[model samples]
Target chain A: MKVLEQFEFLDDVRRMDARQVIYQFLNFCMIVASALMIWKGLMVITESESPIVVVLSGSMEPAFYRGDLLLLTNHHDEPIRAGEIVVFKIKGRDIPIVHRVIKLHEKEDGTTKFLTKGDNNRVDDRGLYAPGQLWLKREDVVGRARGFLPYVGIVTILMNDYPQLKYAVLGCLGIYVLIHRETN
Target chain B: MAVLTFMCFLSTYYNDDLADVNIKVGSVQVKNVADFTTTRERKDLAIINNLGVKVDLSQVFNWNVKEIFLYLTAEYSSDVNALNQVVLWDKIVMREDAQRIDIPSVDPEYYFFDDSKGLIGNENVTLTLSWNVIPNAGRLPRVQGLGSTTVKLPSTYAHSSGRI
Candidate 1:
């Protein structure tokens, strides 16, 4: 009986005003909703499943490096061309590759066949392709390069390279934001 | 409340933006070139002797020496008659060593293609060169590199010399 009474007393002290708690929860929900909306908006505008990507390798060096952020847009009407850099995912490979289109071979049936070569390597990317898959079709492309920023993705690389650091940073930020909430 | 939410969103976005790096593709130049043409007897199909190829290294940059492994490979379409024929048509043709420079010099004579057996037909050929650039090696983590162009054959036609 005594323990139950103490528990009730602690719960009462910990309970925030209903209005204030509702306000905070609603704000958090709004932020989440807005983020979702923005992502959906990008998907619609770019006509791509993924509008943003990070460079995972140095295959496209001098143009894009590891940790660099890339903006992509895939409009089906826009034909893939030689000399343009692209991000594409190969079968069985989890990460996508960024390389330049060195050759374009169009089949008689209106299907496009293409070859990619890294800007930094000596030859084309046939070795990177799946076994016996000599060419990449239009369906394999994620997006064409629209624009990019330099070295800004290093923090992502650091976080990924050291997951503990990421959790610690996130925890600290969450605590700081909660504890330092403005009373006004 | 709205202001707080906006601030939180902005902070998250800013944090996300700061985590990644950016790299750009600049000019690409051919630094090295190799040609492989061979003829062989195949019971399945007739081979063509007019097989000609060009392998070129365009450019490389922003590489970490420690994180990459550089290898040069050539893959061709398997429809050619000389799929496994070994022919010593040419002696040592071209040889080039990898170097650390803005533009590495690649001699075209150290590499050669043997065409003694028979020429492979309709096979798409591919060549690859890969290398890892070490990070924090005092040198800039980024690099702009080049490769060589194909050497002209006696009977082969020349189209602009493949110069970058």
Candidate 2:
């Protein structure tokens, strides 16, 4: 009975004025829109579609661990060098891989191809590439890691792993925002 | 936490430097091997022996540093591609481990293969020592050591049967 009492605030919504209800709903939308605008701004500034990424695997252990936050930047004009950590996506693969560049072959015309291998792994990532694809081109590079933060992305990873937890948190936040009245 | 991490980043951002390194390549031997991983065609695989590396990386260690990923890359220009860089050897130096590297002579850890026969008689091949300083929370600065050495590769291929 006590657990269900939190939802009793639904009655308060019916009692609130129409203008006040609309004002709170608009405030919620503004918060979401601002978050989206910030993300899009980061994409433009970093030149990477996804400027931030979470390390989901331990392939680059001792450097990046699971749930670590990585800041990525993709400068199309800059050349990728050896020993740099790069995040790349393979064709048909949904998840991107973060690895170190061990080999680089650049042509005179500014076209370059490179091979990657995880620092923790024994072999190169040739097997992970698309079938018959020996090298990764500049187009395949999602971004190059520039900054790192430890254990900041655990919340995102946990939400992805557990669907119910994500829904519960989102629902609670929505209800709290809708019922919260600003006292002038 | 964010302020502390930012302070840690600023403290080591410019202070970290990798210098006083000496690298020597004694000999290079190229062999023709089947490229099973990629093209599936026979490619030139070059092996460097008696590699001498001496460096003091203890100064790179700090509270903000987690680990150092050190590697020796061979950079050269080939006919097929203008710029070619290949990593021949690498090592991970944890904060607790010894930071000084004093190898007298050792073979490379990884196979140095060329897409074509570019490794043969490459006189301008340069070997440089570089490392990535992994931080607890900050920029991943890559620093190249001060010293590097270039060695010429043998024009003829070594017999694949004989182990060098």
**Which one is best on TM-score?**
2
Candidate 1 per-residue C-alpha lDDT over A1-184 given as tens digits, one digit per residue, 9 for 90 to 100 = 5675566534432454767656655665676689899999998999887887788888766545788777788999887754456789999998888886654544344466777777667667888899878778899998876655556678888999999999999877654433333457
The best candidate by DockQ is: 2
Measured with C-alpha atoms, the lDDT of residue B134 in candidate 2 is 92
Candidate 1 — which residues are off by over 4 angstroms? A1-16, A177-183, B1-164
Span of 10 residues, lowest total lDDT, candidate 2 chain B: B155-164
Interface RMSD of each: 12.2, 0.8
Q: How accurate locally is residue B138 in candidate 2, as Cα lDDT from 0 to 100?
A: 92
When summed lDDT is taken over every stretch of 10 residues in candidate 1 chain A, the lowest stretch is: A174-183
Across residues A1-184, which tens digit of lDDT does each residue of candidate 2 receive?
5665577766566567999999989988988899999999999999998999999999998788999999999999889999999999999999999999999999989899999999988889998999889899999999999999999999999999998999999999887888787766
